[model samples]
Target: MGISKISEFDCIIFCVYAVEYRTVSGVAGPLVILEKVKGPKYQEIVNIRLGDGSTRRGQVLEVDGEKAVVQVFEGTSGIDNKYTTVQFTGEVLKTPVSIDMLGRIFNGSGKPIDNGPPILPEAYLDISGSSINPSERTYPEEMIQTGISTIDVMNSIARGQKIPLFSAAGLPHNEIAAQICRQAGLVKRLEKTTNLLEGGEEDNFAIVFAAMGVNMETAQFFKRDFEENGSMERVTLFLNLANDPTIERIITPRIALTTAEYLAYECGKHVLVILTDMSSYADALREVSAAREEVPGRRGYPGYMYTDLATIYERAGRIEGRKGSITQIPILTMPNDDITHPTPDLTGYITEGQIYIDRQLQNRQIYPPINVLPSLSRLMKSAIGEGMTRRDHADVSNQLYANYAIGKDVQAMKAVVGEEALSSEDLLYLEFLDKFERKFVAQGAYDTRNIFQSLDLAWTLLRIFPRELLHRIPAKTLDQFYSREAASH
Candidate 1:
């Protein structure tokens, strides 16, 4: 048994704990090997007392009878094998959570980095939460408008769905992520009116944003933007900078998700959890795997990478009788823009859909540069039309997709054969494509558009083609929206 002392006002308190094993036989990377230990459980918390009387935190990674390997959260740089004292806490890692966590800033390990008072937690949730069972989940049927036209009109995000943004290294995914944080919501419209209505507090919308392996400058940008936009009051920010201990990266998303679950399932708040640069999280897993000398899978990643990712991604869903829901948008940068990379390829299988950022459109100075052709939301059909978004949403989305696809094919042909050789009908499609890119896809950084405005803009663009060419749209929809004056112009 170990005895620890705490000093108070002119008094001392002694606490008893489990045996402190002082036989740390080896220290390698972030792991410490302790010999002659008994009854160590996997994932149990371990407190390592240094020679200076300070302590470092770790979790037991593996337990082999009388021996155990622990992964230290603060790393093992100054750990001394001969003098370190390891005390098993007999509990797994957990973080304190409450509704008060909103607007709070925390490090990857769930400690407060902001200059504020500590949280009086309502409960301490296990960091490694179990996935929601598929049989208990409800199908996603509500739309989440991001206020970005490409995502709102073309590939609409649904509540409780897990979608991802597939970006490259240099792509402006950070900016896009911040924008979504500021603008995403479950838009409410007045009965028999097109005007947007503000949902009551019962709607309970919130955001849980986690950034892993980002630099300080990037972290500041996220904080400043959220504060300026008045979103900080409802946002919970978890930042893991590049300079912090690498092992903390493995815990950042889990901590963020646990907080989200608390807010959603307990507080009845609809939560949107955004995880940026998932590639960093994966890389951290690779480093820990290499340290353990585990057999490597594709690209030197751990073979259980898929299962690990599932534990995180599968946490997003609406329980059968719960009032709140968890919707996830996990952003990952594809190495060399290769979607076939192990990271993105596996994500595609687990996630419902993906939103691909276009490098070509970015070069043209487009703000978001979302490529509409390849981007999709599998649950969009279930969430749009009559009561959800608009009656014309599905038709407008279909028409826009068909026309833009044809316009792109014509553009490729123009490069092969001169524009002069193209028929007059082809020229009209070429012009339609130009207008579509300029008017529909492009928007200002802070420009916010509701579902009505987005649908109106799609109709304006579709009018460029003759009414006969608009075969994808229904006749009743055309008669209502396709005016002769707009078509002639």
Candidate 2:
């Protein structure tokens, strides 16, 4: 009989013939230490069988000659070191991939928890996918409209760019993320009107959303939001609840990225991977490091936290000869609103740019309170202007930044000298600051705007200043878009 058709007895005999080590030396929280292990590879999957004939899954975190440290995914609370057996699977952890993954809800370990049918594997891909060669990388230039004025106008997201939303606790970052997932796409009107510029094809667009260590309420909110907006069809969601095993948090993003890679590279889809509350993921890493008795770096995180984060962030990009691309918008809440905290600090160095959400704005009742000045998209310049968004996009953006800077300076002066002491020009700038925050940066949570509408609104605001003060915009652009009647204000 073929090996595949072997009886249960034969299978047991084959398992008995395979190498098994009963050398579990110690259990530390979620980790298991194995001594006298021979040639155990790092990241190798291990099966731990207990005395009750139940098996748990684990991964080899470290292998030093004959000693190996394994992190159990299901925790090690009930395992007895004397009777447990560890068997190395001779393979790294992998996730099954298929096009049907869209609209499916998965747990942290990539297992479907929605009571849906099992995933029919088209292929199995290593969760730790190989990095794209730098030589094979294509520069990201296409603009992705999130329909939020602050993001669309100022910190524009681009295809294949790793842009993170740096937020703090109690901010509306979740609402903003949900809005983007609902409204993000290439503007079809722009494509139809300006055929010369590159635009995202609707059919090729997809989203992979991974929420790590969120509470049950937060998870349900995201699901309801997606389902209500009818965006679940294009989204592959991975929810790692706060109550789930902390060890599983480390694997959540990898699973999400693996599915994104399958969709983008193999299935030729433009995928946006949204990872939220990365602080929780980082905390999980710190916990695992502590469990392993490893020395901690800044803020008790692992010494290799930066390198480990790079493994996840660097997965987003465009490869040469591939029609699809992966763009990442990772969201992490700054601890105590401290951006200098290790989590946000390390992420800032790895990502292309960041979108900062302000607490002050949220407190002011602004729905999507994106703080414009501190936020930026480094790839925005190449992705906007001429045929891409609009001919006046770059000029308008620059003028808005310049005017907003001046307005902020004037506001500071007003606060120091009192508003009564301010000149008419300073007062005008003060008004501009207020209007900019209220009208430009803030919008209703569900309201969506295209590039044209956002730019038009920008022009309307800029016209509040005298035409002579608008030096950033070219004369021709002024003639084309400027409204002289509104400039009288």
Candidate 3:
């Protein structure tokens, strides 16, 4: 029998072989326990019928002989042990996916909430996807331009890489995530040069966005932004509102990634999956663990948090012979801005690298507010260079970083002593610092820059320092791009 028919609990039997247990021994939060159950498989789907005939769906979290614990997706607030009936469907939870899922919005439980027609399933995929074989996986090399200078020029994100945004509360991580979704696309390389504007086409790209435990305002903001920017046509959104059941948050990302995998591998489209506020997801895991009475680890979080996160992150990549690829950009808000928090700490170990959003930069009115010092993309080197971006891309990036580091140091020194006490070279470094933050790092929310535009702006800031002081840049590259007259006094 189908899930649609099973939802109507009036039927005595969901399936011919399905067993019904009227003995619900316990109901704690979203979990319900069934005692004296037999032959129930792990992860099996269950339907609970209340006294009023209302039905809720659940999955077996653990099964031991004739006892099973099921996690109810809709929560068990009013469920009574005496009146509740648990029906085992003998099937696992599966999400229906189709190419038409683009432009559609789904709730945390994978149900359509967009007021659109129900999804005509191309196939029902298990949310727990199979891990890709290591031998069959291909290395990521092609760069995906986010149109944000801080990301594209400095820490480049390659296709099929799993990179995350590290932010804290009160930051504009949501805005940044939305901007990237609207502007991200493949940067077609033109003839061994790093100039991205001359001849490049945005590839056929798709986005699967999942928002966990976000408020109504945030949800509407994303929906409106996607629609306004015309990106909704190529995007699929999964929203788990703040009032949604905590258990549903745990299933949201899996459904999103499963849809992404289908779109990437089956439809031959480059899919970008953006999961925001993973902190809420982790909280939900902790809540479930607490309900299950499992032993708590760091900060009352489950000890298996690292392995659990990996199951989601490792799903993003390219198979050797597949025509499409899946890339992930997960955003997590660090509690109290602690980088060492178990959430981001464990994430750092599993993912490629992280992009840290600084609160100070945000307070300074910087658009992206990304702190370049602590942020890095481990896969950047493989995706940029001669014939990819430009031959001088690497050297220019290094020089920019080196000069910025010195500029910061000089700023500290200037604060210690008056500006007049500093030398001319130190004064020039300070000027470079201002231009870097204003012209290079800071851009309008909607302003999208090509790789060439970003590099040109970098050169403009670099020219503030005398060529003699540019120790990080090679002499050959200096001759090609540096003009003697452009150097400041």
Candidate 4:
């Protein structure tokens, strides 16, 4: 026995895991080389020394007997199989998840990172949580007013909806995300520093931000901004950077959503799950599918890509009985601004609506360069009203969308036949279009307007057009909407 122990510690051999018969020739992990068998599927389990100097459970994925493969519960990144010994615990893997984890941040593997004490173990839900039945879903009625004119008016965001922001490279999608997180909740109380709900709803609102494969600088920026803005108190951030393994990219969203599910469903909090840069997640799936040698789908995507996305999108909703609802805003970067790309196309089909970003607006130096015409929120109308905010809010939004859409078309036509050939009315539309983009769409620092100001500005611009041509608007709206120019005319 003594001789065998020494020889095994010093020897190197090939290993195959039990379940998949996966091989580990030079695969070094936290697990110490134990018994080696001929093939896989051994009921006998092995153990590994965890990073915390405590032991945890794992399975013998492959057994060559003395050189068996162990499927680690926690991944092996810094584990030194040389010194960190392995004792087969004879168990698979499990974690605790119950009512306690309301406001917590965890890694992909379900370990907390809030600098707090370890949680008391309880019933653990799989990090990849299950979705609610579609038949069980209630119709979405509440609108999520982003307070951005382009978004609030044109594409009205609704609560419990899965809305994705589609942007090209070099766009300020990150900035937009940060802005939403900052302004989304109520204002932070300056005097009541300890109070969690100074300006925002303390009991109901919380943000779950998951950054997959972003750089450290970007992660730090997001963390720092949330903290500085006081959104960090209620915000739970899960940061998975580029250096993390490819397998981690797949688990990142699942883990983030799991945390969100815990907070939203169990804790009774209105949850906002923001997944930035889904393209990274898709790439990881493609990598794994390629490794598995599976048949590829369109543009090398997996055949189950649509269903895979549905699994995530379906997680956002209001269950029939729960007061807490989970709303999701997934941000995806289009490849070369290709809307038809599988990532955006499949996403557009799955989600309730999409917030499309315009590169041309960025070229014009517009902050949050939202092209409102093409961008639409499927659930905006339910939230705004004279009682909700203003009576004119809906009408002004309709007019702005109508006029801007025309303006966009007219500008394109003018480009074909030089501006000289365009009619006077078309020229006015052209001027209105330019002014609309600059004044309303393009916003500067310290220039945030409430819903009222945004609607008022839209009316002011529409008044420039002849009132007779305003067939898109209700006559009641025209009679009630007071424009300074209209009074003068």
Candidate 5:
């Protein structure tokens, strides 16, 4: 049978070949090169039986006539080249998905790890998700309130948007990711502006959190935090440990996205997928590329790294006729705080916008530590307005950006020249910088603020300066929201 024809049939039925070959020629890293194999299709799952009775699972990476190369998911250690037997399943990797997956935990390869029973799957979907047609996409508009002031008020994440978090090594990105999982939801209505926190509705919202190459401590933190806060029931967690096989890391995100797509399209749930430390995923890709002896791109990463990332990020969006949508927040740590690193640099191109975590702000003990100047949400404007968030959102966001930019510049100048050299107005901006950082950007990790609370807090901070100083605000908006209470006090 032709391998291509076999693959087509494999998609319909479980194709398990009874023939087992002992023609394994060599083992290198995670790859097992088999010679004299017959018609093994690319990406077909295989069973590698060791000299012992145990069997390991693998996927065909390459096939040339009668020769095939397979990547073992459990890694290639202690396999006798002559005695090892390979069986081609003639099918690609697939995972069982169900709505019951909520609150369950799975490993990188979609195997249960939480001692839960097997999912009664409605369907088994290929982990390599199909690309969304561009013509079928609906623009992301509804806002997803994250409850963090910096993100909610400044870089707002829209539903169906793919926004990334750019962090440095040793930062609190995991904590932030967990916090978002706890507090994220869509606003039901702005019924009353007095207490904006009351408008959140998460009954239809679910989080698919996949942590790749994370340590035991970090994984436990995520699990414990979700459990203690009672948000685990609506979350589907996928964990890949630091010691997991490198090949598994490459598959972890695809499996997670497949589950997300199932939840969004099949079950009609608004799904938010958070992928932590994507740098680890890229590193795994580089390792696999090296084993395949492929040519490297920038910084030794695979040339197809960009294409690979696009497959992940592009899966998140609103389909034109679908009832539910998929939003993504991919967190990647830049090596040595370098924003220009291949990981963050290419991510910037694919994602809607990024929330940059500043090392300097973190050093100063600012929670979330967002460097607002560099952080942006390109879809923020479309999501927040008269009916969506608030009429004052655009003006307030712009004013905050303008004033903060000026305050940062003044603070930098003060550092270069002595503070005594500053003019009176300059010193006022310095004080604004301090208050803005402490009150606006910095908050307790568990402290959750809704969109109205965030905007009200912004107005409170803006009142520190005269109206003329807040030139970004329009005359009508200033007359309505601006209060002179701070100046009176």
Candidate 6:
């Protein structure tokens, strides 16, 4: 049914093994081959058709003009070299995309992972979408409420926006990722570990999740987390594992965004794209740049690393005339717990804001482990509402922040200058800082609170502080939310 050829190579550099193929008619058996071509222009990559009739795409590592090298994208498992066919496509790789991809799971290369049904060939759209026009962009103003007191009150992740989770290894970054995706828009209410999912709208939002350079256990963990939380039905996941060649990690996010663009722009759907551990992707880029013999920048990272990250991150936001939006949350674990790492640093510059998962918070058993002070959403004000969220959300957040900041200063000065030297009222005021962190900063994920309830709780903590301590709140605001229970307790 197909033609065959013989070719040789100097060496083979393996790419990722996206998935296995088996045709219904047995026309394409499990395919794998070591195929190469003879040329210098094509020395970098090769296309080897396996016995199963599927073509494998990859790059060439070592080469001679008579026998150029080839790197197979798919793992070589079932085929021999003599019968394999190698050809050149004359360009970088591209992935297929379409609305039909909504309910499907894809590998880094855009191949179906669930293996349930074949996607219609005609429905494919190229995955390498061009940069969205700047003039066509609209401000990302809608607030995305996570119901986590820390995030809502401090960082305030806006809807139609792009924000990331900056965390360390062993932190609950993925747990937070799952919580956001599950509650996103549908859940009428959310607590730390629980959700009133039945009260949520089914089509409230769609999730596009991409996991790069992860392992089997991590993959299953995400799958189980989503499925158990009832979010699997509306979510699309793309996984490129560490076992896969480094090349796959580089392409994974692009493929994920391409699918998100189609769902958002073409289908009029609001899509939230979540990528975990961008650090892995960065490492992959470094590896490729090294192989390509390019000069390096900060800590062996590609010099264009900043622009490379911007290319992926800048894809998030609302587009004018496009009824839908692409909001992003990319998770990255900084090496050595270093915030200055190039990945997180460049990411900070590109995204609207960041949600930092602190080690101190984790030690205290806080579910989200959010570090309130450093976390911020530059687009928060436009998303909140007087009635939809709380009439006092604006003032309450700013005042609580101002008070807490002052509280920290008071305690630090007290530690240095001696607590006994301070007045009794100052001692009580200093105690307010501890109470704020314990009560508001720490809450279970399953713990549910409406905006008013959360605001009232803030007022409860503020009762411990002298009203003048809240510099951000106007005198009028304190009078409105001030509780009378201050003296009795």
Give the residue spans of candidate 5 off by over 4 A: 1-17, 189-199, 484-489
Output the TM-score of candidate 6: 0.80
- Model 1 weakest 10-residue run by lDDT: 194-203
- Model 2 root mean square deviation, Cα atoms: 5.1
Better of 3 and 5 by lDDT: 5
RMSD vs true structure, all candidates:
5.7, 5.1, 6.2, 9.3, 5.0, 9.8
By lDDT, highest first, what's the ranking?
5, 3, 1, 2, 6, 4
lDDT of 6 by residue, 1-489 (tens): 886554585466789443222211111112222223334353234566667787667654444444444444565454465455565554545566666776677787778888768676434554557777889888876556565777776667665788889998889888788777776662222223322232224464788999998889888888888878777878988988778766678778988988888888878887889998799999987876775566999999999999889889888888899887888999999888899989999999999889888998799776667877888888888766453354467888887777677777788889888987888767766787778878888776656554445666788887776776666777765666675753122
Best by lDDT: 5
Better of 1 and 6 by TM-score: 1
lDDT of 2 at 275: 99
Local distance difference test values of all predictions, in order: 0.89, 0.89, 0.89, 0.70, 0.90, 0.72
lDDT of 5: 0.90
Candidate with the larger lDDT of 2 and 6: 2
- What TM-score goes with each of the models? 0.94, 0.93, 0.94, 0.78, 0.94, 0.80
lDDT of 5 by residue, 366-476 (tens): 998999999999999878877678889989999888888889899889889989899988987888889999999999998999888888889989888888888889988
Estimate, for each residue in 147-171, the C-alpha lDDT of model 1 and write its tens digit: 8899989998888999999999889
For candidate 5, the clash count comes to: 0
Q: Is candidate 1 or candidate 4 better by TM-score?
A: 1
Estimate the lDDT of model 1: 0.89
TM-score, candidate 4, is 0.78
Tens digit per residue, CA lDDT, model 4, 1-489: 365455655867779443322223333433323443343345344455545676644556445544665544445654553445555444433446544554456655566776867777556656557768878776665555454668766666666778899988899898888877766632221242322221223457888888887887888788778777776777777777777665566667876787778777788877889998898888877765664456999999899889988888888887878777788999999999999999999999999878988998898798879887667777667655544455666777877878888898998998899899999999888888988888888775324555556666677788779877677787887886755754343
Model 6, residue 368: C-alpha shift (Å): 1.7
Q: What is the lDDT of residue 402 in candidate 3?
A: 86
